[model samples]
Target: MRLLLKKKSVVLAVLLLVGGLYLINHSDFLMAGLSRSPEIHPSELTWQGQLLVSKESWVDRGQYLPLNVSYQLLAGAPATEQRYLSIGISSVNRKKGSYLISTLQSIFSMSSSEERSSMVVVVLLADFDTGWRMATLKDIKTTFALELEQGQLVVIHVPLEFYPPITGLKRNYNDAPERVTFRSKQNLDYAFLIHYCAGLGQYYLQLEDDISCAKNFLSSIRNRVAEQEKQKVTWATLEFSVLGYIGKLYKSGHLPLLARFLFLFYQEMPCDWLLTHFKLVMTQKATILFKPSLFQHMGTFSSFQGRHNKLKDKDFDDGFYTNPVAEVFSNISTYQKNFPNLAWDAGEAFFWGLSPVKGSYLTVVFKEPAVVTWIFVETGSGTKDLLQSAQVELGHDVVTTGKDKSCKDFQSVGAIENGKFEMQEVDKKYSSASKCLRILVTATQKHWVIIRKIRVTTKQSAPRQE
Candidate 1:
């Protein structure tokens, strides 16, 4: 009887030991579940539930501090898998209006289908208003259903408890108390957003909720990054726009460093200022700005109540110039190297010409006729050097005289007003394909003329069916 009792006790002890080992081995996987609360370590941020923070987020700040903040995945799954790029945008409820929806629309609309596939856009709804956050999420889901389904867009929110005390911050810049509080909170918002996006991709891009994207902006950014990589240029930040915190790109591996810097001095300065400081500390002495900015600010009202912001990027190009094969001829005296062809070329430089009198003309004759669909022309970067008055004309039937080619007849399409002219889906007045497009000056002006941009879209007529 004593030997049978001993065997039973030994078997029960062995079974208990095996169960303990199994639970210990799988504890991390179980605790990291989306539904379960995660175990917190004072020195490290746990990858819990929908929060996909990676283990590499451990930063070596002089002293270790616990980050008790947590994020709620409001929409779309976090991109745990690596992507080519990750875009981070933080939005708050504005007093006057909201630009988040428009910003999202512009990003997806401007990016190509393939470009969208290689990147992830993470939107942090950093608003404290629960109702507003819910409404915004619904709007985004409804408007961007396709993008969300394709895993290109992910939306998230931080509960109020996640933020440290925002009020009663030190006024380092001698700013107003409300302004100080606003900037301080903004700092924390960006820090949390940066940290969250650190592990989503190979690179990260920082954008705002109130901006418009240029056409094929993603491709332009990728090309620039590739150029830098090929040249072996060690850079910390690549700027695509000059506007505050608009189009900044960083490497994913370096994001933890950036997030730590932002977290350490979040209360001392605004996010933009901190960005400059961060760049300096990283040993990047010069600001690398890509010309013909890929993004532009579209919001007039500030996120902070009652303050109006009307900033615009002067170098932003909408990628309109799609002129068909043609030869450009202009009678206006060229300014230095700013030739007539430079205006139509797919580049940032524009054509600068001396002051023009009435009847001065610039003409583009296509090698083959096309069904012209769209034409856009912009003059002068500033008010002083504008083409005061001009008329846009479409020419039909080409004729050769001497060594020069000319249009047989020209019909008025539209006139340049306020130094700008744009027409899409032009009414085809002629029955046949058009031969040329022209700009004829109607009024003389004292200031030099700057043909800043000329864009045309054309489609050939379908082959006639026999």
Candidate 2:
């Protein structure tokens, strides 16, 4: 009887120990896996006041910050008891549409102040397919107006179509559900949004329905903008598309004149595409903030222009020059004939190519005599090879130089073990008072390539003659 009792006690103790271990492991999995929670070090955290400077504190170039600034957290506790901004999402879907929202929520939940100040996820509706979209939209205004805790700013996402009519503006919807046609109406919408946001906050972020903010997107944008602003970049476009070769334009040194003519004569092309190309030619760098106002001003839908097609009589109209491709080519040809040394790549037909001016994110600083640098990150071993094979040339005459130009050859600096090749000081020369530099990379034995990132840095003075 004593032996039997001892056996029973041993079995019970073992069962209890196993159960405790299982619970501990499960708890860790929940916190690390399902929650996707960011780790917070309580000891390392500190609070800082919001940073704001006067417009005059920066330069007066065309650069200006948005008018709305604030954010909120729909979930999670205040990691630190610091005053910060708030951004809220008014809708969430649980069905197929929810995938994006869920992903967004996950990203927001994991975001850090080092990335974004603060963010909130207001689940206005659980299922968007259940006819709750309209109701969700309607409630955003009241939710936004709700006073936040002290020391916090609130930024609301208010749908523009639901708002009341503003006096003195006429709305046109000729391009409904397909294209953006009414320039005045689009501008008016932006004006109203800006004005409304101005009353509520210091900076406004107007995101489109399709855009998915990356975890570090806000932080990246803020840091990039702050750096550019410090350098006094008046006009910045993030994404740049190649128009064509610009050697012809560089030869004539008449890019500004040609661009002016193209802008005036060709008003019908896609503004975003055209502006991006222009940035590539002039600044050799393209950057623009992804915001509703910018979209309204630039985004247009035209099924007639899908991918690349040769210019034809059928495609020509009063807006022929307005088309991004047509306008870009026209400008490229004109600039090429005049400048001749500006080489550009329009990208291949299959590839959408790089945007000279359009950026998924961007910032602008109102300053003068700024410096800019363009950095391109090559991804994939084959892509790096291709980049290495291509030669870059910088010259004053676009029409006269080709692959044989003295400043066209690129030398390999080093190869990254991760399949990337580094090239530095490929071609540098001083002509007149302007400095010219070019970098070219091409694949020696591979096809199909990917670029990781392209960085452009602009500086004002010549490094103090050091």
Candidate 3:
């Protein structure tokens, strides 16, 4: 009886252990299903059709032009219940002498049977003739109305200068006067337009008049909307003239005057970098999505003259460096310069550091033209001492004058240049082993070193992986 009881107890214990392990391994899958279950019914059909649209045609200044556009659906059913489409037009009228009277017409036509979604285009015009600004606005409104009436497309006219003010501006910063008023106006307009679209349960897209739509742009956007309802992305400005980081930072509800003053003084970092660093924080708290590539620019402007019409020459000083090493070093330097008070390893700031353990780390690996860097860590006898002497290998060997061979066998290949291993007593029966290691190697220009796998080995066998 005692032996039977013991066997039953052991079996029950094993069952519980196995059940716990199963839950641990499958937790992510269960959570994903709970969080991202499809909102739309599977039986509901999606729009899967293509429409080829021409680029905006230029009209003579002071002319009220009627744009006759037609949409012939390539596939899918034009069902009234599921289809939602809105169109808008925008133009620029600020340049002198040679001005372009560009007209944009959007048709949000989608079929019910399609799988992919459709996109709405927002046209942007640059270098407009300043002399005929009102004429340009009138032309745009007229063209927009005409397209709506003729094509039966729901249309909204968004003047680039029209925006509801956030509030009556108080003189907060001294540099306010030097800022470009028109640029601010445009940004405000875009913000208001996006908010307006959101309020109406519509997705607003901004596009340049010069870019012709791919035959299936609208269809694609519609499909994307169906797949992900929370695609409410705030588009970044296409013009890089704006300078301000986009992200969240934690602070006391009531900060000391000194802390507030310091924060206000140092908040001019690039927006995308800030967004990337604090993506998790912002996503959780603010419910904002910063779509980095939503605003695609045709090309860099030769010179961008603000409202003052003075020519501004901008230089691209940060030449692209290959991969993780370059990105890590650049991000560290940028953070150090921009955010001096914040520790690099703390909170979301870990996303922007030399040894970034949080978030996704991307490194570009190349075969020929190697770049090398020495990596170090600390470990020692004391807790602080135990952390002092640990270092790891990073980078690749240098290639001279010939076609360099690719190091395909290793994800990251390097040798530990320095440090010694020591075994120290923790308690009477227990001991810990420590090693101070450094690595030296050359990184090929095109090869990438993704730090996806990290391991520490004391002997040929039984290496501990991290």
Candidate 4:
């Protein structure tokens, strides 16, 4: 009797152990079904297709979750027909402030009518907060009714099932668990966004939600694409801003592979670093960055919680300056006939002046009273021929008193230290319109001066955003 009881107990223990192993192996599948909303049918998932997993360690079938994801169209739907360009922007709740509306305004207002017709702007609400998503979509729909009706704007959101286990991810580079989770989720977000926008247009432009666009930026991108075609260069990414993943453009045809790559290694690195690897794997060896960047970062708060950053792209051409018609004059003698006007004009030859004594000045007098906004002056070609000591001043109430037709009354705005000076908002001190901009030599200098650039912007020339 005792031997028989012992056999039965052993059999029961073995069965329990086997059952527990099976449940552990299939926990994700069982939990996924139980936790999913009843409204979501199997067919409603975003990507129905299955990706064949490789035996590689990075993509081990048992380690990574399945690629089947789900999403919802909260607002505008995608156009049926293809477009010339597709602009992808991803947004999340920031701790400090929201810049999504301003970013949308910038893109829509900066793009020309024809440019708008040629492209589609897709906004992905990457945050999972249901209330926040609804509120954001409401704001977007209300603000861009015409654009939504015209099929130029779209809003998409990935359902909760879109992500894998984001928390407690293997910390690479000794990153904190929170940072790892943030970047890992970011990678997944970008992957989902890239996959969604893959077939929407001929090219895909990745942009952040806290950026301002330059005027006619779409036209500039088209021109850059045309130039690439003319050169017959096989490129992966055409960068319009140096900031992280703000203005990166890629061929639409290659987006699928790029998306898959990101999804596979979502936990390993950030989205931008993954992009670099993707570019290299595609046989494009170098980053193709364009000058006069078309986007600028305007967010003071980062999307990552509890972090603050103030990032700006120096190359961004904000289109504040029309370089309005003006006459240039200088007291320093000219070199090789490189007149002072040459520095202000849109040309290669700058204002090359000989050695200057104290009180020598280079002046630019506008044809009308101008509300100056921004000024940037570069006074050196190389280590030599630099304006060693100078100060920039705003001249008001001008009378054509000098022989070169310069202004007389001046107020010091800023000084030229280290051969360069840049200032914004010249109207802060003097609300009245200014007559001229003058760069005066503070002290005598033996080295000749090369006014490499003199970029000026005014309020009247800047485009007003509605």
In candidate 3, how many Å is residue 408 off? 60
Comparing candidate 2 with candidate 3, which one achieves the higher TM-score? 3
lDDT, residue 310, candidate 4: 69
Ranking the candidates on lDDT from highest down gives: 1, 4, 2, 3
lDDT of 2 by residue, 1-466 (tens): 9999999999999999999999898885434323333222233231221222223212112233322211212222322332222232223332222222222322343345444444322221222132444443333322223223322333222233222232333223333322333332232333322232221222223332212223344454456546655877644233211221100111112222332323332323343345456556656454543321111111121112332323212211111011011001111112113221111212211111221111111111112322222222334334342232333222222121332222222223233334333222121221121122233332333343333322222222232121
- Clashing residue pairs in all predictions, respectively, total 1, 84, 53, 0
Clashing pairs in 1: 34-49
> lDDT by residue for model 1 over 1-466, one digit each (tens)?
9999999999999999999999999886544422344333323222333545545544523324434456766677765587888999999998877777767866876677899998999998887776787678777886678888888998876766556678888888798889988888888888888878877888899999988777788888889999989988668999999999999999886776787678788788889889999889888888999998989887768999847997999988755323567888888999999998777876678889999999998888887787665577889987768899999998877777665566878989999999988664463343347788889999888789999878765555432232
**Stretch of 10 with least lDDT, candidate 2:** 320-329
**Poorest 10 consecutive residues by lDDT, candidate 3:** 246-255
CA-lDDT, candidates in order = 0.79, 0.29, 0.27, 0.78
The candidate, 1 or 3, that scores higher on lDDT is: 1
Instruction: Give the winner by lDDT: 3 or 4.
Output: 4
* Structural similarity to truth (TM-score) of each candidate: 0.61, 0.27, 0.28, 0.61
Q: Best candidate, lDDT-wise?
A: 1
Instruction: State the lDDT at 95 in candidate 1.
Output: 83
Write the residue-wise lDDT of candidate 3 on 1-466 in tens digits: 9999999999999999999999999896545523432222123221222212111112212222321111112112222222243322233443221112221321221122231222222222222233343344444444344333333323223322222232333333433532334333344333322222221113334433321122233444455455444655532211211222211111111112111222222233222333333334324333332222121111112112313232221221111111121112112122233331121121222211233222212222222222221122222212211211122322333222232221222222323222222111111121111112222222222221112112111111121123
How big is the positional error of residue 264 in model 4, measured in Å on the Cα after superposition? 1.0
Error of 2 at 300 (Å): 18
